[model samples]
Target: MIELRDVHKAFGPKEVLRGIDLSIGKGRSMVIIGGSGTGKSVCLKCVLGLIEPDRGIITVDGQDVTRLRQGSSERDAFLARFGMLFQGGALFDSLPVWQNVAFRLLRGSLKRPWTEAREIAIEKLRRVGLSPDVADLYPAELSGGMQKRVSLARAIAAEPEIIFFDEPTTGLDPIMSGVINDLIREIVVEMGATAMTITHDMTSVRAIADEVAMLHRGKIRWTGPVTEMDASGDPYLTQFITGSPNGPIETLR
Candidate 1:
């Protein structure tokens, strides 16, 4: 449902994405794994049209996203088909939980009656394992796990066809991360949404990915089904999943 062909991005002399080519099938979960600063995020941003690539093409459902003008109604409508869960949970500190979850519904083309939006928000919160009472509180009142669940609720509130999770398990303990990973896997399957996630968390990758792509040095070093990942025998992927200091991949220390 999504494709990037020969995509490239650079900042001054530092090239981030160098001729990236990738595809994600409809209703499939694709996880991109790599160390920091390897351009996984940049590749994602390019697909979302947040970053204009220096070269090549990106398409969603066969529509070229690169041509969409930012702030134009067309772009807004195009973006409406997608939802995002940022790494930080990124909730508005001042808005009540319901408001934060119903943010997209309260503005732009998705606007709804406040009462209806709040009701939908509550339903989504419940879906993510949060009680309705939690909806009236501020972000500061929630723990990291709760905040992450809230962000998850917000991502699916609009029932988007595609979802992007940026380091979905970041900053959580092992158990909490497991909870979040399970929730992400469950929700994506239930919604039948196309998912693309980028993370260094092997646990998250193991729990959430149907297919995995290893991004290294700004390119896809290896990609295949999760079942075959451990035996793929790609040196870079082996080094990454094993977290070994010795291999084809270099580590500074």
Candidate 2:
């Protein structure tokens, strides 16, 4: 469903992605594990066409992502197939929860009457374990976990064919993190949508990924089925997954 071939990206003197070659199959879940500045998010942005790769190719659903001109109908159509849950909940504080969830549905190509959009928003909220009553509240009125769930609801509201989660379980209690993880897994399977997630949470990785790829020094260090991750015997991956301070990965402290 998605492929990156020898992808390279750099900002001025900083090289982020260096020949990243990876692919996620249709309806499969692939999680990227890496430390800060390792280019996990940059690779994702390249595929989304938010950042252009200086070298190599990125393709999604057989279309060359690099070739799609920004702001064109083709680019809009290309992006319409994806739903994203940003690192932060990113909800509009002024809008009620339901309106935030239905934000996409009320505008642009997916636009619908306010009444219909609200109904769909409510249904999606339910799918994410949120009650209809909570829909009338604003983001500031909700707890951290509830807000994240609302973000999840919004991501799936459009019924996208692909979903990208950027740190889906950040800034929550352990139980809430687990709840979000389980919900993400369930939704991906239920929707049969291809999933790409970048997170530092090992638990989320184990819960959400069918396959795991570890990026080190702007390149793929190790990648395999999640089942084989523990036994991959790669120092870079071990250092990452185990959170060990000592390994091929250099530490500041």
Candidate 3:
């Protein structure tokens, strides 16, 4: 459903994404794994039109996203088709919990009256295992795991066709991470949503991905089914998934 072809991004002298070429099929979960400083997040940002690439094309269902008109009706419509959960929760500190969850419903095409929006938000919150009463509290009143659940609730509130999850399992205890993983799996399967996730957590990969792609040195080093990742024979992939400091990946100063 999403395709990136020869994508390149640079900041003056430093090049981040040299030429990323990958595709995620419809209703499938694709997980990207890579070390720090790799262009995993950059790839997502380019597709979202948050950061324009200096070269290459990105398409969704065959539409060229790189050439989309910014701040126009078309751009707004394109954005409404997908949901994103950023690496950090990226929740608005000032908004109450329900408002945050109902953000798109309140302001976007799904715009509804306050009572209706809150009703939808509460239902979505419940789907992510949060109590309806929590909707009245601010983000600061929640724990890290709760904030993650809230973020997850917000991402799925609109029941988007596509979802991008950045480090979904980060900053959570193992149990909480497992809970999030289960929730991600359930949502992707039940919603039939095409998912693209960037994470270093192997458990999350096992739980959420059908295929896995490894980014290295500004390109995809390996891409395959998760079942074969551990035995891929690529030294870089082996080192990364095993969390070992002993292989092809070297620490950058």
Q: For each candidate, what is the lDDT?
A: 0.95, 0.94, 0.94
Over 4 Å off in model 2, which ranges? none
Which of the numbered candidates is closest to the native, going by highest lDDT?
A: 1
Off by over 4 Å in 3: none
Let me know the TM-score candidate 1 reaches against the reference structure. 0.98
Residue-wise lDDT of candidate 3 within 1-253, one digit each (tens)?
A: 9999999999888899999999999999999999877999999999999999999989999989988889888889899988998888999999999999999999867799999999999999999999999999999999999999999999999999999999998999999999999999999999999999999999999999999999998999999999999899999999998888788799755
Q: What is the TM-score of each candidate against the true structure?
A: 0.98, 0.97, 0.98
lDDT of 1: 0.95
Give Cα distance to truth, residue 232, candidate 1, Å: 0.5
Q: Please give the distance, in angstroms, between residue 71's alpha carbon in candidate 2 and its true position after superposition.
A: 1.6
Pairs that clash in candidate 2:
none
- For each of the candidates, give the backbone clash count: 0, 0, 0
Q: Considering lDDT, which of the candidate structures 1 and 3 is the better prediction for this target?
A: 1
What TM-score would you give candidate 3 relative to the actual structure?
Answer: 0.98
lDDT of 3 at 178: 99
> CA lDDT of 186 in candidate 1?
97
What TM-score does candidate 2 reach?
0.97
lDDT assessment of candidate 3: 0.94
